[model samples]
Target: MGRIEGKVAIVTGAASGIGAGVASRFLAEGASVLAVDRAPAPAPGTDGARFDSLQVDLAQPDAAARIANRCIERFGAIDILANNAGICDYRLLEDTDDATWDRAIAINLTAMFKLCRATAAVMKARGWGRIINTASIMAERPYPSLTAYTASKHAVAGLTKSVAIELGAHGITANYILPGAVLTGITAPLIAADPTLRETYDTMGVVNRMAMPEDIANAFLFLASDEASFITGHGLAVDGGALLKM
Candidate 1:
């Protein structure tokens, strides 16, 4: 039997990248999943797991409630929530407009707050749940032209900690994953266009290679599994030791 057999999970940004990887891993572990993304769901594959796809902009005010309702409707209860949908606006503070900053915070930090708030209620009622958030290596380190992204991610770390403290008594664990230079939908195009970019990112990691989506997915699996029941309010870095250099 799989580690998470019979669990119900909701994975945001599941169309591609790390979100997609997490959804796939969850399905493989015998969990039913609601795969959500702003893009239309992809054609169903032969993963042989219970998978439902939802396309919704999580930044919308009603999106969190809708997602919670859909999970309950489809799976009867919510066991896990993976808040992974995010966008990055590469601009320095001086270059960033108010709209850009707002949008980044809405999607990256605010959406997470909404989702966690909605799902925590469900999880609390059931007395068991797991909330896994996707933060970036930027959550702790700064990069040029990423003022908004960094700020939002740093907020995510704090938010995860707060959720952990609030929900620990209710048997719901809240933790955030910090991933470094993983090859995702966003970075794939850049790497394809300029091969040198791959080397640049690889050098950032002590492993001397860019991280694959599955690399991060492995961390998510552990955090979401019962094995990690005692772990909460932690920032697990799957950054290939890149932060050591930072």
Candidate 2:
């Protein structure tokens, strides 16, 4: 039997990138998943009745409640919540407008807060749950032109730790993953536009290669599994040792 057999999971940003990868891994582990994203239905990596899709703009005020309701309606329980939907804005502080900053925070940080709040209630009631958040290397380090993204990710780390502390007594675990230079759909275009960018990221990691979506997925699987029951309020860096650099 799979590690998470019979569990019910909710994966946000399931249409593409790391979200899609995580959803696929969950289904393979025998979990029923409700895949949420802004894209239309038919979320990638989903199959049959075990995997359902919900189109949602997570930044919306009602999106969190709607997602929670859909999971309960479809699976009757919430076992795992993966907050992985994020948007990147490439702009320095001086270049970033108020709207840009707000939008980044809304999607990257605020939406996650809403989802956690909605799901934590259910998890607390059940006395068991796992909350996995997707943060970036920027969460701890800085990069030029990523002021808004960095700030939001930094907040995510703190938020996840807070959730862990608050929910640990209820048998709930909250943790975040910090991925570095992952080659995803979003970054593919940028790398294509500037081929040298790939080399820059590749060299940053001690492994001398950028991470694949599956690399991040593997970390998610480990944390979501029962094996990680004691691991909470931690930031697992699947960054190929990039953080070691000065």
Candidate 3:
């Protein structure tokens, strides 16, 4: 049997990239998924199993509640939540503006907070849940021009730990994953512009190659599984020892 068999998971920003990868992985592990994203759903010819798709921009004030409701409607209970929706831009602290900073907070951190608040109530009532937030290695060892992303991800780590402590008594687990230099379509264009740039970025992590989406997804699968019942209030690094390079 698959590790997460019969579970129901909610994955945010799941139309593409890491979020999509995690959703696909969850399904392969025999979990039903409620996929939330602002992007359009995959088309009819898409080559994988389907999920119940909810289109909502997470930056919107009520998006979290809407997703929580959709999850309940589709699957009766939310066994896991993968808070994987986020965005980043390369701008130095001096170059970043208030609007950009606010946008980053709203999307990367606040929305996840809201989701946890909304979903936790349900999970608490049910007495079981897994919450996995997507943090970044840059949250601790930051780079130039990444102030907003770094700060938001730092908040994510704190939030994960805090929630884990608060919800543990209810049989809810909250954990964060720190991923370094994952290669996605978002970075594909940059690599196309200059292939060696990918290699340069790869070397920033202890591992010499960029992490694939499946690599991160595999970790999510583990965190949501019964085997991880004892793991909570922790920030697990799936960064190929990127912290060591720092």
The clash count for each model shown is 0, 0, 0
lDDT of 3 by residue, 110-228 (tens): 99999999999898888889999998997778889989999999999999999999999999999999998888766778889999888777897776888999999999998998889
- In terms of lDDT, model 3 sits at 0.88
For the record, the alpha-carbon RMSD of candidate 2 to the native fold, in angstroms, is: 1.2
Would you list the clashing residue pairs of candidate 1? none
Cα lDDT, all candidates = 0.91, 0.92, 0.88
* Native-to-model Cα distance after best TM-score fit, residue 27 in candidate 1, in Å: 0.2
Tens-place lDDT digits, model 2, residues 1-246: 888888899999888889888889999988999989998544444457798889999989999999999999999999999999999979888999999999999999999999999999899999999999999989989999999999999999999999999999999999999999888878899999999999998988899999988899989999999999999999999999999983
Candidate 1 segments exceeding 4 Å error: 43-49
Q: What is the C-alpha RMSD of each candidate to the true structure, in Å?
A: 1.2, 1.2, 2.0
CA lDDT of 171 in candidate 3?
Answer: 93
Report the lDDT tens digits of candidate 1 across residue range 1-246: 888999999999999989988988888888889989999655445354488888999889999999989989988989999999999877877999999999999999999999999898889999999999999999999999999999999999999999999999999999999999999988888889999999999999799998998998899899999999999999999999999999
Lowest-lDDT window of 10 residues in candidate 1?
A: 40-49
